[model samples]
Target: MADWASLPAELVRRIAHCLLYSNDLDCYMDFRAVCPNWRSATDDPNNSTKLRFRPFRWIVVDEVSETHSRLLINTFSGRVIRKDLPLLSKYFVVAATLGGFFVLANKEPPHPAVVLTPFTGHMIRYKAAVPSYVDISGAALSGPFTGNCYEQYKAVPDSDSFALDFDDEEWGRTFVSMRLAVASGMCAFDNWQTTVAVPPLPLSLVPKISYLMRLYAIDPDKMFSDKPVTAFADLPGTGDANHLFLVASDDGEVFAIIKLQQHLKVFWLDNDNRSEEVEPVKSIGDRAIFIGYRRCISVSANKFLSIVANSAYYVKSTDSSLAIYKYDLEEEKEERVSEAIDSLNQGRLSFAKPPFTIVQLLSSYTVNVRESQLLEMEKLKRQQLPSVPVVRGH
Candidate 1:
């Protein structure tokens, strides 16, 4: 009989190294339990040469355990990937970004926060922890993020303004008068640094007009130069915009959308223009926009039968209830939100923090929901491993 357990180290390593498109990570956890020999041959996920940011699309299902395990649903294929991350058992999925990273935080005394790649088990300790009082709404990256594995990242929380920057991580705080959430479906990681400039001075109202006209620099560091002093006086539109949300499409078009009552004005922001007033855009192709929640994103809805293409979706919390809104971009009218998405919140989506919803479950968990089946990661584990070894002494 062939000596299966004694396969060549090179062959064992090669067989376990499954690369996705040769540019990203694939089923990495399964090989670790294949056998003693295979586990020895495979590289640690953190130090592996094969790992690259693949930009996997996923949605957190009905619930998130306080620690240990989670169920993630693929946004496109609806396939489920169950991840056993003990690092995340105590954290909340506070914020997310287009780079396929989930920013996890806990509001307890430790106040720990970390960046996690759910599928691959890549972890980065953050420099800042979420304050027990402030709620993190969303996060944006300045450049290609390589969150260090050393001490917590150097996160700078802005007490004066709402914006929080931790190295390249821009976490959006939710309790301010004005909020900004940035995300792009495309590979915007290449040029996101040039898109987060804030005018040094406060925005002057355009009298009764709802539109904000600004010629502010794309970099906040350029505030002392010469444009921010007279930015808001030459504005268009009428009355104060109730809410403002920004999203970048797959083609790299960044839009700042403002809401006044039921009306929404979409402005095409030119990242290259150092200081220029933005104008309203009439079209944004077949993409759908999402904003004003735990995270904000834009995706193509051309394939969905029920999801309206060229539309926008948002979540708003009133004194009475939390409601989701969908607005048509072309017609400039509000549409009905999907029911399948309505039950997803589970008190996790809220305006308060340090006490965002948290629940406890078994050390083991499973879920495969939405447009597909509720699969068990345990089932996947069984398929991958020949047997579970009972070795002792660490």
Candidate 2:
């Protein structure tokens, strides 16, 4: 046991990689807990060559009655770390996700953005407000930028999408807002430092209102540059014309599934562009792809996206459950015949599967709701009558 403890931290991490490559998450997490060196190895990017772990840390924001921002951390041991969540307010904590390394805001009323990493329970605080250009209904960190989904109104519909660069130190309200609508069906991923927004339909192919459907190709850095931006393009008509398709790719690619008339069709972005109409890459079965809950969605570079769907097909709304699907990508064959043959021998097929094998029984966590409605209620009362509108005389 002393010999095991004496091994260099790097070598232990190598051992962890060997274990992880063999699909040994249990052993890997165990190795991370073996000592301080083992745990530190988990954050080293160089070790990521063999295996990549999600960069962000997730924490459950308990809806306690605390006035200040705080974080509840689990050490993968039973130990928990609690600290202030920067400018976290009681109301905001209820609607946050634990996907990324840090959480920032895109709402009004400027405050210092909150940044935390659960491992150390240490934080970096910035005094800035959420940019006005982008609205964050829900956001997850894809690389250094925050990929967000936002609604235009109070009604149940798709929200406009955009990404904000959280790494910027200036916090000058600079952000890139992509006008992609994933009000209902959309998938997203942060890979290769780019945010890929795929429409539910093969948007690039539709000719009329193609601009509306074409995949939105945006780089938040570029969008935030000092340049006037204007462009328009139409989507090509797919196998059908009425269905919308939205998709997310783990490796910076976008896939779209659209319903034309009543037939469901699938398409992919041949090249990254929101204005070009590409052809169909595949056709899904007659069954439509299932999109999850209003706010319960996440995309990971590991080639899977999670959605909150109903447990039983015919179950009532109250019986719905969350499901996680690992949507795999189609590997490309090399030009070399030997490479092609090697690829064929590997038998790597593109498909989707569930990663959360145990919790096929899990459901959406209840979103704690608080009311700022009292202010509105009072305003409504003041507006009523006011002496019967002065009898149309004032």
The lDDT per prediction is 0.41, 0.31
Model 2 / residue 341 / CA error / Å:
46
lDDT of 1 by residue, 289-343 (tens): 6554223455456544445667776543332333445778788887544211222
For model 1, the run of ten residues with the poorest summed lDDT = 359-368
Off by over 4 Å in 2: 1-11, 15-33, 36-91, 94-110, 118-120, 130-135, 138-245, 260-263, 272-277, 282-394
Error of 1 at 157 (Å): 16
* TM-scores for the candidates: 0.48, 0.41
Tens-place lDDT digits, model 2, residues 12-96 = 8688777644333334565666655776554556644332443222234333333454433221121223446444442122133
Per-candidate RMSD vs. true structure? 16.6, 15.2
Which structure among the candidates has the greatest lDDT?
Answer: 1
In terms of lDDT, model 2 sits at 0.31
Leading candidate by TM-score: 1
lDDT of 1: 0.41
Candidate 1 Cα RMSD (Å): 16.6
